[model samples]
Each structure stands twice: as C-alpha cells, then as structure tokens.
Target chain A: MLHRIEPRSGVAFTLKRGQRLKVSDPEGEQVADLLAFNADDVDEVISSGRTLDYASRIFLTTGDPLYSNRSNVMLRLEEDRVGRHDFLLTPCSADTFRIIYGDEHPHRGCFGNLAAALAPFGIGPDRIPIAFNVFMNVTVDGATGELKVEPPRSRAGDYTVFAAEMDLIIGLTACSALQSNNYAFKPIHYEILD
Target chain B: MLHRIEPRSGVAFTLKRGQRLKVSDPEGEQVADLLAFNADDVDEVISSGRTLDYASRIFLTTGDPLYSNRSNVMLRLEEDRVGRHDFLLTPCSADTFRIIYGDEHPHRGCFGNLAAALAPFGIGPDRIPIAFNVFMNVTVDGATGELKVEPPRSRAGDYTVFAAEMDLIIGLTACSALQSNNYAFKPIHYEILD
Candidate 1:
C-alpha cells in the first residue's frame, strides 16, 4: 500500500532488517528528508560524517550505504531515479525561515515536523541530526565552495529505494521550506516491501 | 594569561557578550574545533545551517557572523589570519576513527573530549553539533561536490579572533584526528580578551 505524506508534514515508523522502502516524488519537484536510527538505541543514530567520510563524496545514491554513528551500516540505497540529493544541508526549520527569509511568522518546518512525528518513539529535537535529503537539488560551487539550493530534477513518480540493514526507526518528511521545493509545496508517497 | 589545550583534549568556558576569543595555532598545521551555545539556554545552540544559509558560502572568515539555532547571532569573526576553515564537518569522534580509519584502538577524539569538557555545564554528546573548525583545511571538488580534508595552511602563531554576540558557553578542542592535523598532534592556544 502506498502511504501518502501531505505537504509539509512528516511520519515515523519502523522497518525490520531486509525490508525495503520506496520514497517517491508523486508530484514533481518535491523533496523529502529522511532519517534513520537504530531501534535498540537512539544514541546510535545515522551519521552523515561517517557516511561521507567513507564514501569520499557528497552525492550519495544507488549502492551507497548509510552509516550509523557507531560505524554500522543502517541502510543501502538500492535504486534511485533522481540522483541528486543533499547530505550537507540540514533540515529546514523555524529558525531557517526567521534567519534567512526574515519571515514574520515562521512555520515549525521539517525539524519541528520530525520532532513531533518522532516524539512517540522518544526522539527529542536534540537527537535529530543532519538528514539524507532525497531529491533535493543542492549545488555546490567548485571554485568558491558556496552552496545553493536548486529545484529538484525529479518528475512525477520518480523514486528511490533503500534496503534496511537492521531494525530501524525512520523519520521522513515532505520538506516544508519554500526554496527547497522551488517555492511550491507538494505531497510525497512511500511504500514498504518485504 | 593564555590558556593551553593540550593535544587531543578540550576545554569549555563561558564568554560574555562583547568579549573576544583568540584561538591560535602555536604549532603550525594544527586544527581546533569550536562550538558555542547560548549561555542562558543550552538548547539554543550554534547552528551551521543558519550561518551557511545566511552567508551563502561555506568558507567563513573575518567579518562573518556565526548564528544560533534560534536565528540569532552568537559570534562574529573579527580577525582571521588563516582564511581557510570548515563549518561542514562534525567534530571527530571514536566512531570516526572506527568507521573511517578502521582503527581497532580508537581514540575518543574531539567529540568525546568536548562532551567530557562540557558535561559540567550539563551539555551532552547529543547537544554537540557541527563545529567551526579553526585552521582546518577542507576542499571540495568543484565538479563532483566531493570533499577532501587537507593540511591546514596556518603557520606557527596564526590565529583567528571572534567577538561574542551574546553570553555564550564555548567548547574548544585540539583536534585529535591525525588526518585533520596533517598526522601530527599539537597543542592549541587561546586567550580571552575584554
């Protein structure tokens, strides 16, 4: 069954070892932020540092392993149609809107959405780390090392698949930031497969 | 008086608004990781996301502002003798050693050191975020967005000065990772100025 995540909202669930997850951009240009944590200990959560250090690249996609802070592989990217993703950029949050956009009223954004979604599993805001931003187009300037968020290349129905390596808690969000989605918000879809 | 952080160790202290912190590489080719938190509330910590988003560039130096997670300015870089630094990499940890280098006897690294030093202030490892790396040289491949850690350009006595924008709790470390300091561990020197 396809599970739908409404625009700017999030969901949390558990995936047993060997189960597969398919996250799809049902509406073109939307991005999803994905986070994984060990079911047994939240402290041993997914780590961008370890994964990037081992991979030696910022563009992670098919065949790449998402690593835990404790040096264990949590998931492997099994398929990816939209290859451009962001591991360096953090999830957009209320502070992001207030600081960068100078918005008078800031939405809680993905960080808040993830915090609320993961609260039932005892994950606090502090425990949230940098996410694997699926289908988010972030371009880094080669000469200056500057970062820019661009519109995702995904068309409708584009998706990525991940195979879980362990029992894992997952937090997935349809990114709430304006710039990340090219100024338009849209829903995301996901499905679990054994 | 100048304070010394011995190799592979760290220290935490408070800095009042308008006070200045000068972190110097007394020995050439050494690196230090620096973190700041709002003194009144530890939850309002320094944020790489807010800083980078507002700056639009990754290479932060003189005249740049380090922002808090709450979208407030925490520190301002007043002077920078070594222009190259990193805000993208997480502080090296035991997991960094075990995961990247496959070290069987891994050192606790800067993450553990910072957690230990800040424990008295009630800050835990989960509260630690990506640091402002002083004198650490990291280069990204322009074409592929791949990242590479390089030897710092700082010579002996090179330093950077930051003015606190608010009352803050600060964590500073003599980075423990070999690759970060060109394979040689050296002490870091710092002084608090009025």
Candidate 2:
C-alpha cells in the first residue's frame, strides 16, 4: 500500500531510503522531484547507481554510473521504486513535439527550450538520457495489461529524500494543464538538504 | 512577449488562436495545450499541439494553435482563469533519472515510481520519451553562457486555454517545492472545460 510522508517537525523535508511519500490532487495528476544533482560533480556515475532527476521529477537508478560526454559524473542512484509507481522516463523532445503537434505550429523545433536550458553544459538531444518519475501512479489494465496514467496516491507534504553521492544538475517542472485525463491535477511539494 | 488567457465567465471554456493565459505563482510556470475539438466530453482530446511549456504565472500567450498528432483538424481555443493558481508537468523516465541523479546516489536500474506507472503501457526502458518542462524557468548566462534555473514570472488567476482538434491526453502536476531552489513549496490549482 502507498503511504504519505510525515516530517518529524510538522514540516516536510527531503526523502531518504525506507521512507514513504504521499500526494493528493483535486482531479488531475500530481508530480514532484525527490532529489537531483549535477552529472559533472563526481568521478564517475557507475552503472547500478541511483539519483533523482528534478527536470522530469522522477527517481532514477542505473547499473552503471552515468558519465557526461565531458567525462563528468551525470548521475547515480542509491534506491528506486520503479516497480511500484510510474517513475519518470525521458524528457519530451522537440522531435516529439513535431510528431505529436504536427508541422503547422509556429514553433518548429520547440524542444529547443529544453536544449537551451541544457546547452550551457553541452547537453543536447542526443546526449539527454532517460529520466525517472517518483511517487506518481499509473494504472495498468489487468486484462490487456495496457498502461494508463492514474491519479497519484500521494497527499500534500508527502515526500522522499535522498543523499547525494555526487554533483548533479536537477530540473523539475509542475505540469500546468492536463485536460486529457480530465482536470485531475493536484499540487505537490519538495525539499532537499545535505 | 508572452500573454495570459482570461475568460469573461466563470465556467470552463476553450481558446482559439490569438488568445492569452496567465499564472500567479510568484515564481511559477504554466503550460497550455491547443486542441481541435470543442465538445463537452472529457475524453475529447484532439491534437496535443502548441504547448506553452514555460510561461510565467503572471501572463502567457495562447494565440497559437497546438497541432494534432493523428488528425488534420485543429482544435479551437478558449480562455478561462479560475480556481487556485496551480500549474503542472508529468515526470520523465529511468534512463533519464540515471543521467540526472546517478552521480548523487548509489544504485542502478532504479527507475523509481515512474517506471511502475509506465510498466503497464509496455513502455519499457527503451520506449520512454523525452518530457516537456511546462512552467519551470531557467536562465542562461550571457557572458559565461551558463544555464540557471530560476523563479517564474507569473501569478495566480492567469491561464491559457486551447481547442482540441483530436483526442489527446494532457498531463500535469502542481509544483511548489523548494528543496533545491530558493522558493518555498506552494500549491497550484488548475481547471479545464469544453
């Protein structure tokens, strides 16, 4: 069963292993990031590592430490809940925009926004790796086994915190509009510390 | 450069080209979609085109039509800014999670909760797509050319609406967490209609 995080001081803090975070949205989905770091901060993000990606708001784990093309540590994971929830995957790309939106829109290569944000670090579409999603839930059709995005089981103040083993750059965004699955949107909070 | 969408009425509405939307999160970001349909159905998503991925909570633009993925018809657009000031974005995936967080922690193959949510879709480690950062803001340094994630430029009651040209699935999450940033975690509200 899913659980909500209750900070000891009545205020939510960062997440740690063996901790549970909960969230509740009015009618839509609620998303949040547990932690994130820069890839270039560590010696090497070995495979079978773990960390959080703030941009996609999901937890990540790897079998090998991720290395930036610049030879910097991209990320490493300590723990994960991918089997439990629909952790985030990869960021939407400009190519996705073309495929989903069509070619008639004003913005031709809209993925440029995300690329621009990562450009300073020399990160690009080809270099962008998969992301992780934490806490959020996605229901699967038991019969067909098809996956569907579901309302999160998390409530307000529910959180998870992780310790950073390396330097990293984290990016997160609270979704703005989700009319596709009804107005099932909710608010979420996050916290991180040393 | 960006604008806001304000409906004259309180009921949920649609938006067309040349419209605007606004948000008020103090340092919040807003994302909007353009649809092709104008029916009173919840699952009437058309094309998920023309996304206002990173608009400040103060004011945004919705004059452009979000394109469609499968159909040719463009969804009409409308505007209605009601309810609390909440914007959202869905998390990404595991490989991405690794790229961003692996260096900070120690674990591998951990996709966190997002993987669980997407598992049902057969969207394995290889199928995840890059996500869109709807409302978060990041600035790039001019002289040093460094990218910095910063506060948003929006406020409450500002919104942008679009018409669905085809059936689309919209994803969102309200974010106000300040674990990595300087702002305090706040809640945001959102609404949608035909």
Candidate 3:
C-alpha cells in the first residue's frame, strides 16, 4: 500500500513481520518523523538507545537491527540510499513549540499530529515516543563537539527500507516545523510491502 | 553499593525501580559504556531511540525520561552535573576494530569486555546492543551536520544519575580504545543508591 502524507500531517498503519516499510523523499530534502510500536502491546515500541546499543553503530546503515527494549528485534535496515537517517535527534513537538516559541503556536508540530493519529489507539502525549527523523541531516563537530541539525542529504527519489522483525504500528509525520529552514518542509511519500 | 570498574573491564548488576545508578569520571575525560536489559526478558533492553524519543531531546539531562522500546519508561535522569552524556553514538566494537584495524589487533575494544560480562547471562555478541556512551563528548557540526566524537568536557568528580523505571541488568565497561585521545581512557566509578 502506498500513501501520501501531506505537509504537517501524519499517517499510521501496521507493518507485519517480514514486510518492509519504505519512506521516500520523492522530491528530496524532506524529513519524516517515524514512530513505531509493537502491534499487540503498543507499549513496546522501538527504543533508540537499544537499537543503537545492539547495532553498535550511531548511524543506521543496511543490516542494522532495530531492537525493542524487551530485547525483541523489531526491524532491520534492509536498504538505505542516503545512509544518514537520524535516530539520535528528536522530532519537534507542541510542548517544544510552546516552550521554545510560546503558547501562541499550538497545533503546528509532530506532538499534535502523532497524538491525533494515535488517539484512536488511546495514546496521548505521555505515551507518544519521539520519532526517528528520517531524511534529516545532522552533524557533530569533531573539534567543538557541537551538534547541528540541517537539511536532508538525500537527492530526489532517495529512500530507506526496513524489514519488520515483528508486527508493528508505524506512524509518520510530514514534519511540523514548517517555518524552520533546518528540514525539507515538504510532503512525504510512504509505502508498505508485504 | 559502590564498585570501581577497572580499565578495559566491565561489570553487570541489577537495578530495581527508584534506584539510582551513578557513573563518575573521577579524573575526567573517561567514557563509560552503559548497557541495560529488562531483568526478566533481557531481550527487551534499554533503547537509545526510545529514551531520546520520550525525552524529546537529543542529549540526556536531569529529569529526562529514558524509555524502553516497548515505549516503557525504563529510567529517568535524576541528577546531572556535566550534562553532555551521549545517547546518540555507539560504543567502540571489536568487529568494527577488525574491519578498521585488522584481526591481528585483538582485545582492544569495548565489545570483548561487554561480551564477557554478559556471557554469563547467556548474551552473545550477536545479542549485544550498542551501549549508551556516557560522559562521552559528541558534537555535530550545525553547518555541515558532521558528527565528531571528541574528548569529554566533564571535569573530575562529575557524575550523572539515572533512576530505574523497571528492574534492569546494567552492564558497564571501561572503554578499550587504548590509542584514542577522544575519550577518557581511564577506569569508571559507579554506585547504586537505594
């Protein structure tokens, strides 16, 4: 199934075991905040710490295992064209906007979009996990050790593919940081293949 | 109980919820590889992805939530002095060494120490996840998004405290990158508070 996630919006679906979820930057330089949970429990979603720990690498490359906190393998990086998908940084949230930009800006971030999409599943702000910022460019300076978030390195039509190790509920957002220059600020194209 | 982790060695312990685990760099510039698994499952372990996601930030700070992949809250940052702990990059591994430094240069990485420590728990290399590189310095250049793993900015006696959310098995290692100047190349001081 293929879907189009409009800007500032999100979509949610289940990715069964062995199926691959492909999120593409069809026009390039866009970012998608990806969040996932176990289809059955929903509580046991992907843990960035565990995935990084188990993979033993910071950057997600092909063959990297995305492990859940329960030590359960959830997904595997089967393919990646850009090889720079971000698993370290966090997605922008409404609380973040409220805190950083003030309360005037409320419904303009992933926090709201994810909450709305997962609302049917009974997930709220407390349960909404930070997402994997796909197609986002980030760099850590070697000398100063400063982290800089930038635009995506992906060219048009660039995409990353992951195989589900178990059934999953994958959620995505067309990044809500619309006014920021750090991300692509474009729409996202997503698909799931059995 | 307080324990001193020797240089190039690692230790494993169980932490119950509300218990705080403190790791300190007594002499400064040392890195501790923190790995945790659910005490009951072991398969579901600490996730860098989840911790960063739930906390909604890239860096760990006091009061940040450390979440498991099950979207379960596993730990919390109760206290922090040098707030530069890295949950983004992964620890140095042996396979990574062999690929970069050749197989002849054996026993010079965190992989062996972590593997040895967790072997008793039936965790093999295939199961070892990338560890949380605590007290380690990682800077991503904002302009270039270039990630630089650097030396610690932490002073001597600096420590970070984390409270357990669930019963967990924590593994700590004194980094084995003997030739690198990027990390604290020393022993780690750890203690558990009730």
For this target, which candidate reaches the highest DockQ against the unseen true structure?
Answer: 1
DockQ of each: 0.53, 0.02, 0.18
Candidate 3 displacement at residue A22 in angstroms: 9.5
Name the 10 consecutive residues with the lowest summed lDDT in model 2 chain A: A5-14
A1-194 in candidate 3: lDDT tens per residue? 67888887887788899999988887777888888888988767666645654454556778877766455778888999987877775566654565545668576577678778887876655455446778766555444444455677877898989899899888798887743325446778888887
lDDT of 1 by residue, B68-96 (tens): 76668999999999999988878899888
- Superior by lDDT: candidate 1 or candidate 2: 1
Interface RMSD of each: 2.2, 16.2, 7.0
lDDT of each: 0.90, 0.32, 0.71
Q: Against the true chain A, what TM-score does chain A of candidate 3 give?
A: 0.90
- TM-score (all chains, Cα) for each model: 0.93, 0.32, 0.60
Clashing pairs in 1: A142-B142
Best-performing candidate as measured by lDDT: 1
lDDT of 3 at A100: 47
Worst 10 residues of 1 chain A by lDDT: A47-56
The regions of model 3 sitting more than 4 angstroms off are A1-194, B99-103, B178-184
Error of 3 at A79 (Å): 13
